[model samples]
Target chain A: GAGVSQSPSNKVTEKGKDVELRCDPISGHTALYWYRQSLGQGLEFLIYFQGNSAPDKSGLPSDRFSAERTGGSVSTLTIQRTQQEDSAVYLCASSPTSGTEAFFGQGTRLTVV
Target chain B: AQRVTQPEKLLSVFKGAPVELKCNYSYSGSPELFWYVQYSRQRLQLLLRHISRESIKGFTADLNKGETSFHLKKPFAQEEDSAMYYCALGGGRGSRLTFGEGTQLTVNP
Candidate 1:
């Protein structure tokens, strides 16, 4: 893809439901990242994937938040038993490699009612 | 841990006026700082990075390790500069970037 692509641009779910956000990174990109943006707030780091190495999960807020990347191209962010506080836009980004300027996705706005 | 801090949540400036958006960081090692922006109904985009040491859209940022700051400055503010700005830090062998709370800059005419 020419740019990072995220699925289901908007999502609304009941509290405690599980939601999955998907990201398709640019071709040949080696780094993928997921972030959360609350209402009128900054991007919150969630997880990072570089190649086949272990992912950096340091930023995941809780055990309910998890992510996985397959074949180093597509990634998914899963938030289980979502809470009201989880209502936010989930953004995904990809860089040609680590330490480079990243390109971002349109983001999936999740609304936990 | 590496973190980015943007002091102001809202900044208002007049057209052609000089403007500055403050940012600070905390890290154990050398920090790679970046400024990202978001226009209305647009996705977040990178503005500039400390390592590049380049200016974009008349905005420049100098990384000062002595004070742990990377402030974005512009000599003449434009109406199009009215947007949300975020300061971010990227380093420590991770692909992720840590971002600040963001500052909404409004360049008034």
Candidate 2:
């Protein structure tokens, strides 16, 4: 079965520019997540979506960070006016539901220059 | 707030030697703990969860409420066991996880 897929394996953009990272969860998976991994750091939870439930966005570092999942399958994380601090690997994951083993993507390395 | 701490940034053990990766966590209530592993060039994956109370690939972990710890252990480490290990805490009904900085294990054969 296909696991979580993230597009744009790597991205380099200027500061203040907007960037959108995409994620495709496994077929039938109802839970999706976005996380950030800085250099030599742990995974920072960003957002979560489970079924038709309200998504959890408390982990977003700032208002510039936002995400939306359409049709409960594909998700996109948008960073408005990206900062150099946003340079990190963006990871996406999906599971059958909360508490299940979540499958992760290879991650998209975003570099805000 | 929930947090997981992996004190050791790196661990090295010879093949066939015992290995233990320390993990400590803090949460006000009953917490769910997990171990996630990522090999070089591979995606991160779940290694085990404390609730399952099951061993995978000769590795096991026991959650200690008294100590607020969930350390991973293996009787004899193998070369293939070398990888980055992350301690995570799953919180609330959403199951969002708080992770540690991760420890890179090196099994020298």
In order, what are the TM-scores of chain A for the candidates?
Answer: 0.98, 0.98
lDDT of 2 by residue, A1-113 (tens): 56788998999999999999999999998888899988877678899899899999988999999999999989999999999999999999987877466789999999999
Interface DockQ per candidate: 0.54, 0.55
Task: Compose the digit string of candidate 1's lDDT tens values, residues A1-113.
Answer: 67899998999999999999999999998999999989877778888888888998988999999999998899999999999999999999998877567889999999999
> Which ten-residue region of model 2 chain B has the weakest summed lDDT?
B90-99
Question: Considering only the true interface residues, what is the Cα RMSD of candidate 1 after superposition?
Answer: 2.2
Off by over 4 Å in 1: B92-95
The backbone clash count of each candidate, in order, is 0, 0
User: What value of lDDT does candidate 1 attain over all alpha carbons?
Assistant: 0.90
Candidate 2: lDDT of A30? 84
TM-scores of the candidates are: 0.91, 0.87
